[model samples]
Target chain A: MLAFIIRRLLQSMIVMFFVAMVAFLMFNYVGDPVHQMVGIDTSFKDREVLRESLGLNDPVPLQFVRFITNAAKFEFGISYQHKRSVTGLFKERLPATLELSFVAAFLSLVVGVPMGVYAGIKPDGWLSKIFMTFSLVGVSLPTFLIGILLIYIFAVTLGWLPSYGRGDVVNWGWWSTGITTWSGLKALIMPAITLGLFQLTLIMRLVRSEMLEVLRTDYIKFARARGLSDRAIYFGHALKNTLVPVITITGLQIGSIIAFAIITETVFQWPGMGLLFLQAIHNVDIPIMAAYLMLVAFFFVVINLIVDILYYVVDPRLRLDLGKANGA
Target chain B: MNKPLLSVENLRIEFPTRRGTLVAVDDISFTIDPGEILGVVGESGAGKSLTGQSIIGLLEPPGRIASGSIKLNDRRLDNLPYAQMKKIRGKEIGMIFQDPLTSLNPLYTIGRQLTETIQTHTDMTGKQAKKHAISLLEEVGIPAAAKRIDHYPYQFSGGMRQRVVIALALCVNPKLIIADEPTTALDVSIQAQIITLLKKLCADHGTAVILITHDMGVIAETADRVAVMYAGRLVEIGKVRQVVKEATHPYTKGLMSAIPSLTHRMEELTQIDGTMPRLSDIPKGCSFHPRCPECMDVCKEKQPELIDIGPTQVACWSYHDRQI
Candidate 1:
């Protein structure tokens, strides 16, 4: 068991390395860093000095090695646009994006799974037809459009929430009154809902399909034959069998959430890593952009790793029977 | 003799389809006296499993009992509500399915499943239920029952899992146990063990069984009375010895000749000429007439009603002249 896990972990590290390398190369090679670092109005001597200091004089391989080694110590160089430490810039913006994604995902699972199970169990019922119709609409509409609609309804028309920015953080610490604090939560609602809508549809569709398949498995029939209640056949037998794929889809969804939050943050004028990512791109802030890209890739790799481990834990066939040739 | 344990009269199941309604199980009727093992033998798509499932009120969707009456110890069972059916399921009539590996829930320990059934039907506390579960597991010949009760279903082998299922069926002291192809999913050697275990356990407790299978060898070895089903109807019903030794109906005769045995060695085992007709494609007269070797013109024109002949009931025009 230990050997198997160790081998899997080593493979994971190799995959993560390739992911980090690609993300690093994309931002680094996309544009000239020296011109941006020295600015548009720098003298030849100043440009030369900036180039030397920023390691533009070094080879690309050496530069990547330096970047990677510095990243290992979390000492990404200062952002030219903000004049802030790369770590500090990311630290300030990371929490809002994380919080938004977490809440959106939580809401999606809480709503989507039950809806999917209900619809799958009664595919021909009126409730199922309604849910499927809603899901189709939800899937077809873009998040940006949904975000704008939410802004129009809640902000412009109703005047129920603020249009942008992080609200009073001092009055709304971790242990504030509740989720209904005037500042932080009230500000988070619109963007979270907009982001959660599409994810909810994806989750619901995948869950419905997976649960339908599991419900048709031999084991479920066996459960029914054993005189188990309908509730037991559903939640007890079908639900657990469906969770493996659900976990994978959910993990992949987390990656997309961070990727798509860029638009959502732009729409709501929310201060998050998405906003920072846009700023880094506009000003050609290489260190910050590289750092941000690496961070996103890191999240993708880490989430996938956690999902893989969970798959092993949830299914014994994956754990005990890995040595056999993969087949049905 | 005491009252019959179970009685079914004119039981029929139908499915609504685009091509009109399909009769899955036609008007089939039979009765099991107390402590009788009635072996139901038929090929796949013969509606054998459906018969077992219908008795327990677990038929899947799209199928409905079109008309029938099921009586358990003279009590009407066909129209009882779900709650009452549940009350009878594990308490009065225990069920053992085909595959033991999938029959038990993987998430729960065997002990928990057994104890849950006990606690659901009987007036036993958690501790007492646990004790009884372990003892029941031991009675089913599971080794280290005291410790193994806490182990999940996946931990046990195929044979052991079937034993656990048997133990669960026996836990309630049910009057009739439905062992639906109980040993069909195990290895040949393990199959004997399970068959022996089932016969011995049911005998000890005076519990009747309805053993449904496609294997005639098992019926010959285990059953007291055997019912032969074809297309969805009972083709013949008689004592196991009489039916296996001397079958009356042509379908039963074909089934008997088809079983490859030491004494029956021919160029090809005398297989029934054609496939078993699908429930949707059953012919007008006798469902088996198209496939029977001794089919007559009258057999294709009129359906044969089951008639008593000596100690056997044969549903064929050839034997219809015999009086009850």
Candidate 2:
């Protein structure tokens, strides 16, 4: 198991290196930091000094090595748009994005799994039909449109919520969460739903199909023949089998959730990393963009590694194969 | 007989399709006494498995017992509520399914599976159940029962898995066990070992068995009484020695002749002329008439009812003296 984890860590390092290289390449093409940093009245000699100090005058390979080394230490220079250190900006905004994504993911799972199981157990029931219809709507409608619809309903029509922005936040050291405050939570509701809707439906459909497939397996039939109670058979035997695939899809979907929260963030004007990334893109803030890319890549690698380990944990067949491989 | 352990009377199973209701198990009747092994032999699609499933009340949907009474120790089982049936299952009747490799859940340890079944049907504590499960594994001949019980199903070979399946069925010591083609998925050499283990365990537990298989060889060795089914009906039933040596029904005789013999080497193995008829297209009269070599004029016009013929019960026109 330790060997397996070490091997996966090595693979993650390789992936992160490639992403770092891509982020380094983005720095060269996306406009010079010197122009963005200085005013028109600044002398050319001052600009040259600033460029040299920033290591823009260094060899390309040396600069890339520096970028990689600095990235490893979580240093990403300064955001040109905000005139603040890129890491500091990320540190401030990451909690909001992660908070929103996690809540959305959690809501989807807590609600979606049971709904999926119900639909699967009784595929033709009236409630299942209603869930299927709702899932269809959740899957088909775009995130931005959903966000606007929610805003129009709860914020405009009902006057129940704030239309845009993180309403208020309570700081717990470096981490600031809007959930601790009522107005903040109410403000979080619409954007989180909009961001989580696609994933909710995806999880629902995947879980439902997987549940249906698992229920038909010979083991399930045997479980029934063993005269196991319906509850034990469905939840204990069948649900555990379905979880392997659901975990895989849900892991990938979570990575996408964090990476793709840009539109939803923009729709609600939520003060999160996605909004930061969007503004960075418009202003051509290369440091912030590069940092965002590396962070997202890191998330993907970590999630995939976690999913692989979960497969080993959930399935004994895989564990035996892995043990053999290690022993050999 | 001292109160038959299980009895089925005129059981008719039907599948309602878009075309029409197709009879799968057509008016089959049999009884199994306590501690007796009854072998049910038939060709594929002969409804042998359906009969077993119906007895266990685990028949798949769209196919249900249309008219019948299944009684266990004189308690009516056919129309019992699902909750009542569940209580009887595993506690009163156990089932061993074909394909042992797939029968056990791969995600669970054999110990957990066994203990869960034990706890479900009994009032045993978790620790006691585990101890019982380990003992069961050892009884079925699994090596290092304590250690092996924690191992998942995939760790065991085909023969060993079948042993585990047998152990599971015998865990509760139910009065009757319905083993549906239990050794069909095993290797040829492993098949004999499984059959032996099943026989020994069932005997040890005093668990009567309905051994469903197509192999006459298995029936001859393992069963006390043998039932021969052709299509959806019981064509013949008698003592194993009598059925193997002196089959009276033409279909049963054909089935006996089809089994290759080592004592008298034959130039070629005998085979029945035609396949069992499809459920939707079963013949109006004797379902086996089309394939019987001794097919008579009356055989094609009316179905023959089972009648006592000295040592055996034969369902054939030849056994009956009636003209019509």
Candidate 3:
């Protein structure tokens, strides 16, 4: 198991390296940081001096090595728009984005799994039909539209929530959270739902179909014959079998949730890394853009690694195979 | 005879489809006394397995008992509510499926599976159940029962896994076991070993068994009484010796002859002329008449009911006339 984890860590390093390279490439190609920083009337010689100091004229290979090394320390220079250290800017915003994405992912799993299990156990029941219809709506409607619809309902019509922005944040050292306060939590509700809707539906459908298929397997028939209670058979035996695939999808979906938080963040104007990334794109803030790229890719790699470990834990067949391969 | 452990009277199972209701097990009746091993033999689609499923009240959806009474120790089982039936299952009646490879849950340790079943039907605590599970595994011939108990189903070979399944069925010491083609998925050599183990275990537990299979050899060796079903109907049922050596029903005779013999070498093994009729297209009269070599006009015109002929019960016009 130690060797397996070590191997996975190695693979993650390779993936992060490629993402770093992409971030580095964007620095060279995507607009000039010096041009964005300098005043419109600045002298040419002064601009050259400023560029030189920023190492813009450095050799490509040396600059790439510097980019990789500096990125390792989370140093991405300054955001052009904010003129603040890019890492510091992201550090302030990281907690909000992380909190939002996690809550959304958690909500998706907590709500989706039971719904899926119910729909699966009784595919033709009226309640299943209602769940199927709701899932269809969740899957078909775009995230932005859903966010707006929620805003219009809860914020505008009902006057129940704030339409935009993180309501209020409490800071604890480096981490900031909106959940500890009432208005802040109410503000979080719509965006989190909008961000998590598609994923919840996807998880529900995947789980439902998987549950249906698993229920038909011979083991389930045998389980029934064994006179196991309906509860034990469905949740204990059947649910555990469905989880291997669910874990794979949910892991990837969580990665996408963090990456795709941009849309929800923009819809609610929740100040997070996504809003920072979007503003970076508009002003060609290469450092912030590159940092965001690396961050998202890092999330993907970490999630995939966690998923691989979960597969080993949930499935004994895989564990035995790994043991055989390691001769342990 | 002492009170029968299980009795099925006029049991008819049907599957409602888009076309019409197709009869799967048509008016089959049989009884198993305590400690008796009753072999139910038939070709594919012959409804042998369905009969076993009906007895356990685990028939797949859309297929249900159309008309019947299944009694266990004279308690009506056919119409019991699911919760009530569940109490009887695994406690009063255990079941073994066809493919042992898939019968045990792949995700669970054999010990967990065994102990879970043990606890479900009994008052044993976790530790007691685990101890009982290990002993049951050892009884089924799994080596190093204590250590192997924690191993998952995939760790065991096909034969060994089937033994685990047998152990599971026998864990609670249910009075009756319905083994549906239990040896069908096993290797040729492994089949005999499993059959012997099953017979011996059932004997040891005094568990009446409904051994459903198509192998006549298995029936001859393991069963006390043999039931021959052809296309959803019991064609003949009698003592194993009488059924194997002196089958009176034409269909049973054909089935007996189809088994290859080592004592008398022949150029070819005899086979019945036609396949069992599809449920939807069963002929008006006797279902097996189309395939019987001694097919008579009367056989094609009217279905023959089970008629006693000395020690054996045969379903044929020949026996019907003799009885009259």
For each candidate in turn, the TM-score is: 0.93, 0.98, 0.99
Q: List-wise, what DockQ does each model earn?
A: 0.38, 0.79, 0.87
- Flag the better candidate by lDDT, 1 or 3: 3
lDDT of 3 by residue, B1-324 (tens): 478889999999999999989999998999999999999999999999999988889998989999989999899999999999998888889999999999999999999999999999989999999999989988999889999999999999999999999998888989999999999999999999999999999999999999999898999999999999988999899999998888898888888888888899899988889788999899978888888788889988999999888879989987786773
True contacts kept of each: 0.23, 0.70, 0.80
Local error of candidate 1 at residue B36 (angstroms): 1.4
How should the candidates be ordered by TM-score, best one leading?
3, 2, 1
TM-score of chain A of 3: 0.98
For candidate 2, write residues A80-170 as lDDT tens digits.
Answer: 8899999999989999999999999998998899999999999999999999999999999999999999999999999999999888899
Model 1 residue runs over 4 Å out of place are A1-9, A23-28, A59-62, A171-180, A322-328, B263-268
Instruction: Write model 1 residue lDDT over A1-328, tens digit each, in one string.
Output: 5565676678877876676687678656778766666657889898888888888788878977887788878877888888879898777777788878888888889999999999888888999899999999889999999989988999999999888876755424432221445677888888888888888988898888888887776566655544556787688778887888899999999888987799999998878889999988888887877788778877887788788888878776675466453331
Selected candidate, larger DockQ, 2 vs 3:
3
Ranking by DockQ: 3, 2, 1
Candidate 3 lDDT over residue span A1-328, tens digit each: 9998998899899999998998899878887878899899999999999989989899988899999999889898888889889889988999999999999999999999999999999999999999999999999999999999999999899999999988888999999999999988998988899999999999999999999999999999888888899999999999999999999999999999999999999999989989988988888889888999999999999899899999998999999888888899
Per-candidate local distance difference test? 0.84, 0.92, 0.92
Cα deviation at A318, candidate 3, in Å, is 0.8
TM-score of chain A of each: 0.90, 0.98, 0.98
Cα deviation of A90 in candidate 2 (Å)?
Answer: 0.9
Which is better, 2 or 3, measured by TM-score? 3
Worst 10 residues of 2 chain B by lDDT: B315-324
TM-score of 3: 0.99
Tell me how far the alpha carbon of residue A209 in candidate 2 is from the true structure, in angstroms, after superposition.
1.1
